[model samples]
Target: MQLSCPLPKFDFDVITLGHGSGGLLTHRLLQKGVFDILGNEFLGQQHDGASFHMDGKLAFSTDSFVVHPIFFPGGSIGDLAINGTVNDLAMCGAQPQYLSLSFILEEGLKTDEFSQILADIKTAADKAGVKIVTGDTKVVEKGKGDKLFINTSGIGTVHPGAAIHHQHIRPGDRVIISGNIATHGMAIMSVREGLEFETSIISDTVALNHTVYTLVNRFGKGIKFLRDPTRGGVASVLNEVAELTELGVDLVQSRVPVEEQVEAACEMLGLDPLYVANEGIFLAIVSEDIAAPFLQALKEDELGVNAAEIGVVSVNHPRKVIMESRIGGSRVVSYLTGEQLPRIC
Candidate 1:
């Protein structure tokens, strides 16, 4: 849903170097542009840094978004920035509560565009149950920066029963994927290439904290490891796990889930679906006993309807990922060597 707060009246139509000067222009931008849209009690304090209290274990993560074009099929860079950091905390088995948002704007960026981005940020934070507590903004020369770049730092309280670590991974543990892969990368590529297909391939950039918290609450230590395949996709993530634990990952090619249209897009673009980025889904390494229930619970959640048990931890090929084809042949799914897609997040 769109944010209820609309952009306040402004005297400027485009960003300028003066806006970053921390003088009247900067004050006006924050007071009218940002404060009006994302203002909350925490942010209203208006200090250089935000302060808050929390109990028990905490998880902190920060990420920067430099996605080119800044806008795409299902989402823009605004929501992407929020969801990325929120998901980082969620993967650590935490309930996200607050976030710090920062932005670097190019001089020529339109005020309308900036306002829309802030609105989207508010909507995404609300959806993820996180508050934008503090932030900073700076404007650079037109040629010095992209249209806009965002940096988000998030904090959350860890679940009491959570014991997420790679060392807990075992030979019998099953690898589960929360949803379909390759959609987000394809969505960005489609816009970049201006490619049209039978059906639109939209980005899967929704937040996953609620769904992840549910699984962590029920399965606890049964979920040994959790990682979201973002930059290098599933292959790179599984390879990292294999190398970390000196274990093998055996994946069935036929069982890996990909949407028909996305699969077709990959074939057309000569890209492997496993090497494409995914923003919304995650990879979970869980004990064999809870694999079935984990997959079921994931499917019941709104975010994980396409969840699947794609592979298993093994001792056969230590530090290697092997994908068995439907025709009974196997091949190594190695780490992503080069950049398949850049600025994908």
Candidate 2:
């Protein structure tokens, strides 16, 4: 339910040390800023922690967001915190149910900016069908901290029969990417580095839980494995899983989806799109017999329109990843050896 208390106006335009002092100012800041916008039954109780129920096998995950330039093309750190955790649970074959938020704010930061972040957090949680049950807030000395940072913890229930993990991946399982790669990394780089492209390449930041639900519910165990290529990009994920399962993966460089602008940007920056990051896209390794129908269902969703079969698991080069070029040659695609873009979600 919505909060009934009238929001108290802050006397100061920006936050101060008093706001983090655990005094009347602290209560007022949460009441008028955070709780005022995100009030719900569990949060309205105002206890030290929140209580909720769970059934079936449960999945839990937590992550922190320190994305520089808090605001990006398609989303901000606020929504990123919520969606990132939610996607983590989805990749584990679970249905996200609840989330807890914690904020670290810098002294002298604008109160209005924090309020906007809270508003975006609410929008993202609602869209993902999850609740913000509890949270904490703290303030740091001005120069010691960035404008803002967030930490989110999530819990979800695993669907029955949806047994998915990297261990299940084996020879013959087909690899499919939900959409274009490297969009998010490039999107952040363009704005941060002041490189302009003909088209505005926004970050592909979105929730993937719903689409994951559709696949898990329909395919069940046939969906052997699922993963959202985040910080390490698709290449990193493939390399790690290959080493884990001790099976080689052969990817077609041409089959991997890369946007025209993103490819060009990568070329100019002397970067490989395979090593970039993505927030909204995912990879699925499914049984070959089920890959066709699964791809059809995935493409039905807006995010998977450009989805394609990129590769397959092989036993020849165990514990390695090989990429077949569009020119009919093969080469090794190594793990991400270093960071390409820092503070990119």
Candidate 3:
């Protein structure tokens, strides 16, 4: 949903040190801009911190976004901030409810750009069915910081049926991917490197809480483990699981979903798609019996249309991830050695 609220009039066109001074300028910015746009019952309290009650099991996660070129294809840093934390909680099998949003703005940042970001944040929170309850704003001198940086802390109620852990993952469990990989990272790189494609490769930044909640509620223990491949991508997550469970991860190159454009971009850039970052996809380890239905159910969801059983757990090569090529060869997929893409969400 697009932001319906119009930008309110501001005394200043660009933010300055005074705005972060916590005095009259700060008050005006909050009362007239931030609070006015993000006002909710909890945030309306105007307290240093927000207080709320959550029953039963709870999951909390915090993350910071510093993607270059704050605005990118399909999403901006604003929505990326909200969806990043929300998806992190979802990976823990929780239903995200509220978030605390904070901003580190540069002194010379334009007021209009900031306003647009706030609008995007509000829209993303609404779509994710989450509320921004409380937050803090600080300004750093220009050149000392990026255009803007966002930090978000989220609280969610864990699904009662969730039993996600490495212990539940067995040798025969199937490894599932919610959608395509390397899309988000490629989207950023295309812009930063001045690369062009026949079709725009948009960032797949989205909230997966609702999709995860449905699967966890339906399959219960059938869903062994869940994780979103953000910084290190699918290879990193699978390798980590292998180390913890001491089980082999057997993957089929053809089964792993990858957009043709994204794959081409990766090949041209000398980047490994397995190590590329993905913002809107997840890795799921499920029981052999439930893998089929789980994949079918995920495909039914709009967020998981490209879901696929990309790999499986095995005892053949314990603590290693092996990918079988389409041509019948195999290679061991190991943990990422260094940062593939820095400042990527």
TM-score per candidate: 0.97, 0.95, 0.97
Candidate order (TM-score): 1, 3, 2
Candidate 1 ranges beyond 4 A from true positions: 1-5, 193-199
Model 3 RMSD vs true structure: 1.5
The Cα local distance difference test for each model comes to: 0.92, 0.88, 0.91
- Alpha-carbon runs more than 4 Å astray in model 2: 1-11, 193-199
Candidate 3 regions with alpha-carbon error over 4 angstroms:
1-5, 193-199
Q: lDDT tens digits, residues 82-150, model 1? A: 999999999999999989999999999998888888888988999999999999999999999989999
lDDT of 2 by residue, 1-345 (tens): 122233334556898888888888888888776777788999889899999777779999999999987888787888789999999999999999999999888999887667667777888888899999998889999998999999999999999979898888879999999999999988888878566555578889889999999899999999988888989899999998899999999999999999999999999989999989899999999999999999999999988998999999999899899999999999999999879889999
Better of 1 and 2 by lDDT: 1
Candidate 1 clash pair list: none
True-vs-predicted CA distance for residue 3, candidate 3, Å: 4.8
| 67: Cα error in model 1, Å | 0.9
* Model 3 global lDDT (CA atoms, 0 to 1): 0.91
Show pairs that collide, candidate 3: none
Write candidate 3's Cα lDDT for 1-345 as tens digits: 245766655667999988899999999999888877788998888899889888999999999999987888878899899999999999999999999999999999998888888988988899999999999999999999988999999999999999999898899999999999999999988777555455589999999999999999999989999999988889999999999999999999999999999999999888989999999999999999999999999999999999999999999999999999989999999998988788877
Worst 10-residue stretch by lDDT in candidate 3?
1-10
